[model samples]
Each structure stands twice: as C-alpha cells, then as structure tokens.
Target: MTSTTQQHPLPLTGRIAVVTGAASGMGAAIAERLAADGASVALLARRTERLDDLALKIKAAGGEAFGVSVDVTDQSSVDRGAEEVRQRLGRVDLVVNAAGVMLGAPVQEARIDDWTKMIDTNLTGALRLAHAFVGDLVKAAAEGRTADLVNISSVGSRGAFPTHGVYSATKAALTQFSEAIRADLSPADVRVSSVEPGMTATELGANLSDEQLELLGSTFAGIPPLAPADIADVVAFVVSRRRELNLSYLVAVPTRQV
Candidate 1:
C-alpha cells in the first residue's frame, strides 16, 4: 500500500470572509474554498453580474455567499462596498485583497497611462481594500475573534522579466506594504499574511500581448502552471491556524518550477 499525506482542512464554520476580485480566477477559487470550509463569504469585484453568478452557484451548493459590486480604484466605492458587506454579513473575520490588473510593456513604448493604471489598480487598489477592512479586522481582534488579512503577491515581485518590470514592481510594493501592516497589526489579534505564487494559470495573465504572453510562456514552459485553486488552498491553510499562530507569509509554486 502506498502512504499518502492527508492535508488539514480549515474549520471556518459561520465565520465571515470578504474576497475582492471574487468574480473569477484565483479570487473566485478562494471564495469558493472558504465557503466550502463553512465560512460565509462575500464576493466583490467590478463585475456585479459575474459576482451575482458566482454567488448563485455557491448558494445553490448550500453555502452561505453574498456578492457586492466594487471598483478598487475608486476609494469611495470601496468604502461603500465594505460597509454594505458589513451590513449584510454582520461581521468580517477574514479579508482577501485579490483585485488587480497587470500591464506588460517595454519602458520605451509603455504608455504612462498604462503604468498609472497598473499602479492605481494593483498597488493602490490593495491599499484601498486594506484600509476599508482594517477597521473590521480591528473590531474582531478587540472582541477576541480570529481574524486575517491576506494580500496576494507574486514571484514576479522578485523575478525580473523583460516586459514585466512595471507589473513586478507593483507586486513587490504589495509585499512590502503587507509586511508593514503585519507589524502594525501585531499588537492586536488580527493577522496579516502575504502569499506569493509563481506563474499561475488564471485570467490574471490575459492582459498580456501575444509577444508578451510568448515571453511569459518561455519562462513558465518547463514548470507546471498552478491552478487558481492551489493558491486558494494555501490561503485556507493560513486562516485555519490557531488564533495564536499567525501565518505571516507563504510562498507556493509548482514543484516542477523549482
């Protein structure tokens, strides 16, 4: 008989978790995983219709899920969306800032507009969600509830690619920002964690041009691209930890990649 390691499933019954960018890709996968583990999930993204569809699916499957429409680039929109989630869900225990945009362009031809959009959507976007949710997390901590704030980063944050310069910088900034928040929130029971995944197979890379996609292809060819669910599993594990054990950082990649 072959021996296999059994993974620990997260216990999240009745807990409330909010996931941004939950319309599709890793965001959707993460939301589904949390709901499956017994948490009530609130999905947020720019596409309200998509969010509605996902929420329907989760509800059909006998899970608790609610969807909200939000644009992370707009601070006021994020603020309102957060409050709406709080009102509907009653409380928030976990917040995942998974909303983002990626732009690949050479420095010479990359429009400043593209760069600005990338910054606003990727870096500042996370900032907006975190700011809006920090209050809820603090409240949970004060009440001695288990809480978490997870920011998705990327291996590109450290790896240098020909056209990935701008996008990489944005993810790197997210990592640093998460670190600072982790330190600041340490006194409270709220845990801040960063998860960095490499070459994931998701819509996240759909923004690339043909040539840019080819470039990414070469770097990822030998390595098996991880599905969005893999990253979601990592996050689930982090949150499942005892309140006393804070998972500060997690880096997961396909085994073949290394």
Candidate 2:
C-alpha cells in the first residue's frame, strides 16, 4: 500500500524576515514566531546585547536568526542594517516595523523632548525602515514570493486617551501611512498591513511618568492586557495567507477591553 498523506512545508519556509525592536516585547515575540515558522530572521534594534541574547536563544531552538544593531531613528543606521540583512540572509520578503515609544503626560505638561522622541521613533522610524527595504520586498513579490510589510500601530490611534495625545497621533499617522502604501504596493503583489493592538503587556510604558503610569494602571484596571505573543500570532497569520490574499489592517485587543 502506498502512503498518500504528505507533510506540507511551513508557510514561511525559505523566506527572510526582518523585525525591528527585536530586543524585547512584541518585536522579540514576532521575530521568534517567524523564525519558528521557518523563516530566517534578522533581529534589529539599538540594544546589541539584547539582540545577541535573543539570536542565541532562537538558534538554540533550531531556528535561524542573527542580531543587527539598528537605530530606526537614523537613516544611515537603517540602511546599514538592511545591507547586512541582504548580504547575510538574501532578499528580505518580510519586514515588521515594531519599534516604538510611549511617553505619556498631560498635553500642557508634556516635555517637548518626549514628544520629539515619540515622533522620531514611532513615525519617522517606520518610514526609514520602509524606504530601506521596500525595493527588496518588491523584488521578492516580482519573483513570485509572498512579500509583506507589517506595521505595528495601536488602538489608541482611533480613540482618545487622557495623556496619550502625542503617542496616539504617531500611531494614527502610521495607520494612514500604512493604508497609503498598501494602495501603492498592492498592484505589485506586495502585502502591506497595519496591526493595531490595544493594551498589550510589554515594556512600552516603562518610561512613563509616575503620574501617567498611575493613570495608565487605572484605565485598564480590570481589563486583562494582551500579550506580546498574541500580537505575534496575528502578524504570523497575516503574512501566512496566500500571496493573492491580503489582510490589510487588524485591531487586536483583549475581550475585557471596552
């Protein structure tokens, strides 16, 4: 008797993925998940030590991974990181822009520097990454491979929060930019997606002022926060879809969140 059933290869099996902010939190989770799914992952962040630690763990788990020191706030840094990924891992077919900062304070009391940091990291950073890798993504798509650019936005983009004005603005801008680029890239068979998560459990708020932290704690007092792995799962699902299908935008939140 001939056995007919056969195992299918992993969806991302031969793809190359790059994840920014990969030292911790959502970015780290996403990189790990992608690598486990069979893609060669390049972890990018300013924290070289953390990235190296993550790379070692991924390799130990039988996944291919390498760490690259990248500061998304700097164009030169991003360009260099992209070059390294290309030279080491081949053309990138998956790029996840997950680097961000959330420094919350009352509008009137908000430090100008905080606002600048947020804008530079959460908005311009995403743009720098997209510019550095869009060509590779396009080439991958043209070669009949699944190509994706996923941006991590936030539900705050659509709702008003007491002390998250600037943060929300950056996310809102990200969402809009994601949509515009989707339009431009869809014709080339490149999938672009914006994933908005609500109240995820991560270090995104570690830099908040004590008062703002208190407010943040109270706002989600009873609602359980989503985990980084949760967002990573969403991203994996989005990119694993058939090349002809696109999950353009998604909002992920805990059920307890109103």
Candidate 3:
C-alpha cells in the first residue's frame, strides 16, 4: 500500500502547525503526517524524550518538525510552548488539539481526581491552546493564507458507555466547542473542525483498571480497530482542503465498531 506520506502531495507547504499530545499515539501520527504533507510541525507534550525522538523521525523522512516540552494542563506552559513554536516555525497556520486523557470507572467508584484530570487536559487544555494561538491563526488568514484548528474528539462523544462518563463528556464538549469556534472564526477565514474517531488501537486507555480492560477486551474481542494512521489521514484531508469548503465535522469508526 502506498503510504499517505507518499500518496498525498504537499498541499501545506510553507504552513506551520502545532500538535499537542504529540509524543505518541494519534498525535504523533498526525504530526508526522502533517510534516509529510509539507507543513513544519511542532510536537508538544510532557515527555521531552519522546517528542525529540518523533522529531528526529520526521526529519529523517525529509519533513520538518521540532519538539516542545509542554504540560497541556498548565496555561503558562502552553503559552511558552506556543511562543516557542512561533519563534521556531514563524507562525501557526494550523493547530491540532490532540492532547487528551481517558479514565474509565463506574460513577460510584470514579475518583474525583480522575474526573478533574480529564476535564483539565481534554477540555481546558485544548481551550488554552486555542486561546493562545488565535492571534496567529487570524494573522495567517489575514495574510491570504488558510488557517485551521482541528480538535480530536472520540466516538464516545456520540453516545454513553459504561465507565466512560467523564471521558465522554469531555469529548462531547470539545465537539460543541469546535462548532462554536468555527462559527466565530468564519469571518476571519480561519477554519475549525472536529474529528471523532472510534476504537483505535492506542495507549489512551492503558490506565484502565483490570475490570475496564476486561470489558474493553470482551467488547472489541473479534473486531479490528482503526489504526492511528487512519485517523491522521482524515485529519490531513480536512485541513488540506481548499478554503471554500469548511469540511467541518467527521466521525470515523472501525467498520466493525458498531
């Protein structure tokens, strides 16, 4: 199969992008894919080592990428990271709010701390980056260039699942936030989109308890999950489109994920 890197032309040449949670999983894949499509990508995460390693890989692939150490939950950290990205990559034309956490537990057993963590990272973290980078996005659009903000949501946002209440809430809120931002930014020619993916194989749920794991295992037992690359491909397509079409919302799931 021809890889997306090899298949997609460089539509994002001269563009700059920021991707949070870029140390691994879909964030890493999206960062690499964006670079491949000819954007200079900034990889942001708490793990400097992983971000460095991913940056090296993108550079090896003839794509431009840099690592920025950031804790998405911290506003000051996000501010610093955004400034660094501006310094390093010039200006941000695209931003991906991929930093997120999923903690699963029954409502009765769920810890308040876990709920707080989810709300902070998944919702507020995304909001912070958006707030910090709006000026850059608006500037790019004003300069006759297309600017984009892509938020990564989840299938859980579409419906309720046992032990996934808080996680689902966060994602659903993100989707709504994206729509509102899209409307608000339309006059500026800055595009906003939400990408919701389902049942992808990633470490997102690695922290789940044994019971949660068992439930997931039984739920997805014979079904194949979407790869990180699959979702990345969709993201690249959305952001790469011509400015006339918004390509606002998408929900991609494994064919068997019903």
lDDT of 3 by residue, 111-141 (tens): 9999999999999999999999999999999
Q: What RMSD does each model have against the real structure?
A: 4.3, 1.1, 4.1
Sorting all predicted structures by TM-score, with the top scorer first, yields 2, 3, 1
lDDT of each: 0.89, 0.95, 0.93
- The alpha-carbon deviation from the true structure for residue 49 of candidate 1, after best TM-score superposition, in angstroms, is 1.4
RMSD of 3: 4.1
Per-prediction count of colliding residue pairs?
Answer: 0, 0, 0
lDDT of 1 by residue, 1-258 (tens): 999999764499867999998999999999999999989999999898999999999998878998888989999998899889889998798999888788888898878888988899889999998888888898988998898999998888888878878888999999999999888998987999999987788898787899989987887788878999999999999998889998888899899875
Among the numbered candidates, top TM-score falls to 2
Candidate 2 per-residue C-alpha lDDT over 1-258 given as tens digits, one digit per residue, 9 for 90 to 100: 887988998878998999999999999999999999999999999999999999999999999999999999998999899999999999999999999999888887868999999999999999999999999999999999999999999999999999889999999999999999999999999999999999999999999778888888898899989999999999999999999999999999999897
Better of 2 and 3 by lDDT: 2
Residue pairs in clash, model 1: none
lDDT of 2: 0.95
